[model samples]
Target: MAINTPPIAFGTDAPSSARGKQAGKARRPVPAPRPGLVTAAAAVVGVGLGATLALTITSETSSEFTGPGGVASFAGNLTGMAGSYLALVMVLLVSRIPFVEHVLGLDGLLRWHRRVAPWPISLLVAHAVLITIGYAQTAKTGTWHEVGTLLTRYPDMITAAVGLGLMCLAGVISIRAIRSRLRRETWWTVHLVMYLALAISFAHIIVLGPSFVGHPATQVVWSVAWAASAGLVLCYRVGLPVVRSIRHGLRVVEVRPEGPGVVSIVCSGRNLNRLAVSGGQFFCWRFLTRSHWWQAHPYSLSALPQPPYLRLTVKSVGDHSASLALLRPGTRVAVEGPYGTFTRHAQRHRRALLIAGGIGVTATRALLEDLPRAAQPVVLLRGTRQEDLVLREEVANLVRRRGGKLHELTGTREQQGLDEQSLPALVPDLLDRDIFVCGPEGFVADIVATARALGVPDEVIHYEAFAL
Candidate 1:
C-alpha cells in the first residue's frame, strides 16, 4: 500500500495504438440522458401518490369517525396509507431504472433515497402506535393488551410486526454514525432486509387495511402498483445485471498498482464494444471469488474500454477493496452498471474545469478522455503529497493532448486549499466553464459550496462524492 504511481501492466493486450483503433471500432455510442423523461416520470409518481391518498380519504365515512376511537382510527389509516405509499416510492428510487438513473445519477438517486427514507419509517411507526391505541380504545382494553391480542389473534399481524422490526433495524443502521462503523458488506446485507420487510408487510395492508379490505377496485390498483415496482426492481437490479455479466463474460486479466493503496484491475471480456457506458459512470463490480462473490462494490472506470479490455481503479479503503489487489487473473467478474450522470454529456459550457481530490482522480482521468479537444479543460489534481497524486503523468498527457491546462496542488489542506479566491485564481475563466468535481465527501462538499458561493449556477456545477 505505497502511494507512488507504478507502470501499468495490461498483461497480454496488444499495442496501445492498435488497441485504440480496435476499441473505437468495437465501442457503441451511449445515448445522452433525457431530462424530460425524468420529469414525466416524476409527474406520474406524484399523481399515483395523490391518487393513493385520495382513495384512502374517500373510503372513510362520517359515521366511522364518530364512533369510539374514531379519531385515532382515521389518523392511523391516513398515516398508514401515506407511509406505505412512500415506502413504495422509496423502493422505486433505488430500483436502478435506467432512464431515471441516467438523468439523476446513482449519487442523486441515493441522496433522494436517504432523504425520503425517514418519512416512511417514521410514519409507519406512528401508524403502528396509533393503530394499536385505536384498537385498544375500541376494545375497551389497555394498549399493551391490544397489541398482544393483535399479534395472537389477527391474521398476518405477526409477520407485519416482524416486517416493522426489520424496517426499523434497517433505518437504525443507515444512520451515518452507525453506518460508518460497519463494513460495506454488512451494511448492504442489512439494507436488503428492507426489501423483505416491504414484501412481508404488504399482505397485512391488503388483508387488514380499511381502505382495501372490502374494496376490490382499491385492492386491484394497490396490488398492481406494488407488483410493478417489484417487476422493475427484478428487471433492472437483478435480471439486467445477470444478462450483462453473462453477455460480457468478463474475467480478470491483471491487477496493476497505480499509487499507494491503489490498484487498477484489467478485465478481458467478450463483446465489450457493445457495452454502452459513459466516461464517468461506475459499475457495481462483483468478483466471483470465495470471499467476495456475495458482495459488489461500486468503482468508476479508471480508463474507458480498450475493446476486449476494461479497467477499474480501486483504493484499499476497506477489506473488499484491499482484496482486489490479490485478485488472481482469470477470476470472473459481474458488473451491474455503467451508471451515473457525471459525464461530458453534462457539460453546458464549451470549456470545462475538472477537479480531482486524492483518489477521486480515477474518475476525473476517465472523464477527461471523453472531453472534446476544444473543451480546453483545466484539471486540478489535489493531494497531500506529490506521491498521493495518483495517475499524474497520464492526466498531464491527456491535458496536453487536448490543449488543456493541468495543475497539481500538493501539500496539506492548510497549505494548498481551493477556497473561493484560490479556485477562481487557478481557473480564471471559471465562469465560462462547466465545473466537474470528484473527491471524498468533505472535499466535494467544500468545493461545491465554494462554487455556489462564487455564483456558479447549480446546473453547471456537477460533482460525485465517493463514500462507502
Candidate 2:
C-alpha cells in the first residue's frame, strides 16, 4: 500500500536514506546520444537505396522492353528489386543498432518499422503476380500451368515461392486486429521466421534477376550489402547481449513485495558500478530458469544501481510478469540493453513535470534521483486507488529533498480526470517546464494529447508507454 509520509512504514524494509547513499556511490556517467551520427547514417541509407534503383534501371535494355510481354516483365523486375531492397531496410530498422536506438528510442524505431512494413510486403506480392502473368503470356500458356512450369524448370523458384509464402504469413498476422488477439510471445516467435524467409529468398535474386544475372560487379555489391545487414543483426541482437550478460554475471538475491500483485526483484551482479546506464532506461531481461530462459521481457529499472545490486519492479499482468514473483534466490539473469530515450538527457528546460500512472511510478521514481535539487520538479502520481500508487513514499522523499512538489490523484478516471483544463490548473506553470510521462498506453496517450492541446511543444514532452 502507499505511504504518504517519511515516518509511515511501507513494504520496503530498507531505509530510504541508506538506499540513496548506495545509489549515489554507484552512479556513473552514461554517454550522451549523438543525433548527428544517426542523421549521417540515414543519409547513407538513402544514397544506397537510390544506387540500387539505378543499378536495376541501367541493367535493362531497349530490346527487352519491346519483346513479348516486355512491359509486364520490366515492371515485375522493377518491383522485385525495389521490394527486396526495402525489406533489407526494414530489417535494419529494428536491428537494435546502438546509435540509432539512442537517437530514436526503441518505440520510435518500432513505429517506423510498422509504417515501412506494408510497402515491401505489398510490392513483393505485386512482383510475384506480375512475373507469373508475364511468363504466361510469353510462353503462350495458361497462368496456372506457367506457375507449375516455373517451379519445375527454374533453379530457385520453389524456394522463392516458399519464402514469399512465409512473408505473406508474417504480414497477415501482423495486422493490428489479428496481432491484438495473439499473445506477445506467439507473435514474436512468428515474426522471427521472416529472417529465415529472407535468407532462403536471397539466392534467387542474384541468380535470376535481370539486374544481376550477367553482371559480376553488380552481383558482388548486392551480395555484400545483404551480408552487411545480416552481420549487423547478429552482432547487436545476438553477440553483444551474450558478451554483456556474461561479463555482469547477475543472479537474483531478493524478491520483495511492494503492493498487491506487484514485487521488486533485486539482483546482485559483478561490476554493476561499471554499468553505464541512465535512470528511466530498461533492459530485456532473461531469467535463467527452465520456464523463462527461452524468452526475454523488457522492464525498466526501478531505481539507480546500488553498487552490486540492481532492481526491477513488475506487476503481475501476464504469465511472464506473474512468474517473476515466484523466482528463487540465486536465479541467474541475462540482460540485453540499457535502451530507451526517456531519461533526463531529453529534458529541455531547467524545471520539469514528471507524471506517473499506476505501475509506471517505477520509472518516475528512478528518474527523480537524477534530477538536480535546483530543478524544483513537480510530480503527479495517478492511480486507481491509494494502494495502487506503488512507490509513493520514496517518490515523496525524493521530491522533498529536491525542493519539488508531489501530488497524488487516486480515484477512478471519471472522478479525477487529467484533461486540458485540469492539467493546467494543477500546474499553473506547465508551459515553462519539460514534461516526462510514463504509464499504460492509453494513459500516456491521453496525457500527451492533453499537454499538446494546452500548447506543450513536442520536443519538451518525453514519454514511455508500457504496451506490447
Candidate 3:
C-alpha cells in the first residue's frame, strides 16, 4: 500500500517519452473491496433468521429470556434483522461509511453485531438440538433417529444441512485469529458464501419449521417476508450499483491529514448528486485504485452536511491503515457513507459531555462543531498523551466558540487522579448533562465508568464506540 508517485509529465508527450507512459499505466494501483465488515454483516443476517425461528419454536418462557410466543423475543428477532438489513442496505447503496470503510469508527453498531451474531449461532445450535430431541422423543429408538429423519426428508434435510454448513463456516472464520490468517481477497470469497447459505436457510424455514410455516396465511406471509427482505437487499445492492455505475463515475480527488496519522479524503463523482448525506455520519471507503475497492474500509466523516467534497479521518494502525503516511495530497480514493445514528439529532440533552481519546476524537469533533453556538453547556474531556491527539485545533475552536469547557489529560498521574479531577471540577452538574465519549476500547470504558461515578445519568451518556 505504499504510494506510487507517477513520473512527472510535461505539457506534451515527448517523442522519446512514450515508454514512461506505458510504465506508469502498468504501475497504477487498483482498489479492492474490504469484506471483513461485510462478512460480519452477512453473519448478522444468518443469525437473525435463526433467532427468529428459535423464538417461534421455543416452548418455554422465563424472565431472563422469552420463548418465540413472547412479545419481547419476537420483537427482538424482528428488530435485529431489520437493523442489520437497514445498515447493510445503506452501505451497499452508498458504498462507504466511517467504521465500515476504515475498519474502525462508530463501534457500538459493531459491538451489537458481535453480540447478536452469537445468539443466532446459538439458536442454530439450539435448533439442531431441539430437532434431534423431537425426533428422539417420538421415535422408539432415540439414538440416530435425528440423522435418519434428516436424511429421509427431501428439502428439509438438504436445506438444514446447507444452513448449518454456512453457519459453521461463518462461525469458524469469525474468530479474529482465524480470520486474520487469510488474504483479504481469499477471506471475502469465503465470506460471500454466507449469501448462498442464507438463501438455503430461507427454503428450510419455509418447508420445515412448524412455528415458521404451519398455517396457510403463515406460508404466504413468510414467502412475502423473504421476498420483501431479499428484494430490499437486491434493490440497494444490485439495483443501486447498476444505476450508479451507469450514472456515476466513482473516483477520489484528494487525501489530506487533519492531525497526526489521521487523513481526510475528498471525493467527487456523479453519485455525489444523489447522495443526501448529513453531518455526523460515516462511510466505507474503498480507494478504488488501492488494490481493493472490493475490500471496502470504514471511516468517520470529519466533514458534515454532505459537502460536494467528501472527507474521512483515518488512523494508521495496521496493514490497511498504515499506508496513510504514503498517500499523496492529491491521491484519488473511492468514498461511501454517510452512515451512523450519532448525529445532531443524536443530541438530546440540555448539556452535552464529549469524551475523546486518541484518534477516536473524529465524531465527537463533528458533534462539537454541529452543536448550536449557544450556552447549552458542553464539557469536552480528551484523554491522551500530550502528543498524538487528533483534532485539537478544531476542538479548541469549538470549545471557544460555544462557550463550553474543555479538559485535557495525558493519562492518570498519581496526584491528578487522587485530587485533581478536570471534568468534574469544571462542571459539577455531570448528572444533569448528557455525555458523549469516544476513544480506544479501554479508554472509552474507563471514562464511561468515571461518568457513571460522577453521577452522569445513564440516559444522558452518549458515546460513539470506534472498534469493530
Candidate 4:
C-alpha cells in the first residue's frame, strides 16, 4: 500500500477580500507528532524485521532448541518481523513517487492505500488470533504457570497487541462515511494517535524479538533508516521552516484586488533576493503583525520562483482572512519555505498535457509561462464549475500564446461530485508528452487516472494541489 495523501478541509471562512489583502480564513497542515518520529519509526521497523529474519532462519538446533518455549519465541519473532517489513514498504514507496510537491501526483498510491487498508487489519487480527491460540495450546500441553510466565513477559506479544490495536482504530475512522461524520479537528486528533501506535509497535520489536540487540548489521540498518526519517522531519517540518522564515523576511509590497474576495499579495524578502524559486512551488507566508506567527499560511506564488518580489494569489476563504482587505502595503511578513518536490515534469517531454480545475490551476499556472510554447506542443485541459472559474481569460490567452490546445469543462457538479470523465481519445497518441494536473482532490484524481488509462506511464505525470 502507498502513503495516504488525502486532502484536508479547513474551517469555513468569512467573505473574501479583494486582491492585495488578507482573507477571513486560516489554513494549516497536520503536525507531525515528533520532529523525527515518522522516519525514526521506519528505521525501527526495517532493522527490527531485517535482523529477526537473519536469526530465525539460521538458528541451529543447539542445546537451546527444544519445546513450547522455543515455538512461541519463533512465532512472535516471525509476526513482528513481518509487520515491520510492511511498514517499510509503505514509507519507501511514498518517498519515491516523483514530483510530490504541492500534492500527491500518483493518485493510485492513495487509492491503493485505501484499498489495501483491510489487508493490514486482517494481518493484525491473524497475529492476535494465532498468538492467543498458541497460548491456549501451550497451557493445555504444559504447565499453566509456565505458559503464564511466557505470556506475561514475551516481547512480541506486547508490541503486536499495541501496534495491531492502533492499526484497527486508524482503519476504522479513515472510512469515508465515518470521516465525513467527524469534525475536522477531532478527526485529526484521533489520527495523530498512529504515531504512538507505531512507537508502541517499535517498542515491541526492539525489546522482545531476537537479533540485533548488538549485531552490527541490525545496528547499521536501524541507524540509517532512523537518521533519514528524522532528518526529513527536521528539515522539511522544522529546521528548513525556521530558516526559510527567518531568511525570507517578506514585507507586503502590494495587495491588489482581483475580485470580491480574492487578493493578490506581492511581497519581498532578503532571502528571496537570492532564493530564486520558480513558479509551481509554494511558500508559507506569515504576516508579521502581532498575530503573524500564529497566522502563517501556505499560498502558491503568483510570480515565478526566486523572484526579487514574491507574489501570492490568496482567496478570502475564512474568518481570519477578513482583515486582508485592510492589509497595508509594506507590512512585515515572514515566509517559511518552498517545500515539496513538484515542478514542471513537462520539461522532460517534447509535449505537455496540463489539467487544472478551478483554483487548482494555480498549481501549474507557472509552468506554462516557464516553458517555451512554440518549441514544445502543450495541451491544457481545465475543469471547473462555470461560475467559479477565476482566471479563465488569462489562461485562455496563455494557452493561445503558447500554441497549446485548451479544453475547458464548465458546469456545477451534482452534490455527489463532478461526473467522472476520461481524457480525450487522442490522448493515447499524446504519448511522449508529460501531464501536469491540479485542482480539487477529486478533479485531480479523475484526470490522472484518465492519463493512465490513455497509457501515460507514472514518470510522465506531475501534479500540484491546494489540498491533500
- Cα deviation of 372 in candidate 1 (Å)? 1.5
Q: Which 10-residue window in model 3 sums to the lowest lDDT? A: 8-17
Off by over 4 Å in 1: 1-26
How do the residues 335-411 of candidate 4 rate in per-residue lDDT, one tens digit apiece?
Answer: 65554435553356767776667666554565565555553534444443454555556566667776666666665
In terms of lDDT, which candidate is strongest? 1
Encode model 1's per-residue lDDT on 1-468: one tens digit a residue: 222232333322223332432444646778889999999999998998888788878888988788887789888989999999999999999998998999989888999999999999999999999999988888899999999999999999999999999999999999999998997778889999999999999999999998898898889989999999999999999999999999999988788887888888888888887889877878999999999998888899887677688889888987888989999888999999989888989999999999999989978988888788899999999999898888888788888888899999999999998999899899899999999999899999999999999999999999988863
lDDT scores in order: 0.88, 0.87, 0.55, 0.56
Cα RMSD of all models vs. native, in order, equals: 3.1, 3.7, 11.4, 10.0
Task: Provide the clashing-pair count of each candidate structure.
Answer: 2, 0, 42, 31
Q: Which stretches in model 2 have alpha-carbon errors above 4 Å?
A: 1-27
lDDT of 1 at 139: 86
Window of ten residues with lowest summed lDDT in model 2: 1-10
Writing each residue's lDDT as its tens digit, candidate 3 over 1-468 gives 232232221112112213322221221111223547767866875785565445554622353233332343344334433433332333233232433533333454445555556555555555555555545544534537656766676466677676667866876787789888987567668866656766666666556544444466766765675576667656654565455544545444555555556665555454343454434556666655555546667677664423233456778887677665455444445443445655555455666767677777777776666565663645454544555566666677667767787776566544233122755776677666667777677767777788777766665666666654
Positional deviation of residue 298's Cα in model 3 after best superposition, in angstroms = 1.8
Q: Candidate 1 at 179: error in angstroms?
A: 2.0
Rank candidates by TM-score, best first.
2, 1, 3, 4
Instruction: Give the Cα RMSD of candidate 3.
Output: 11.4
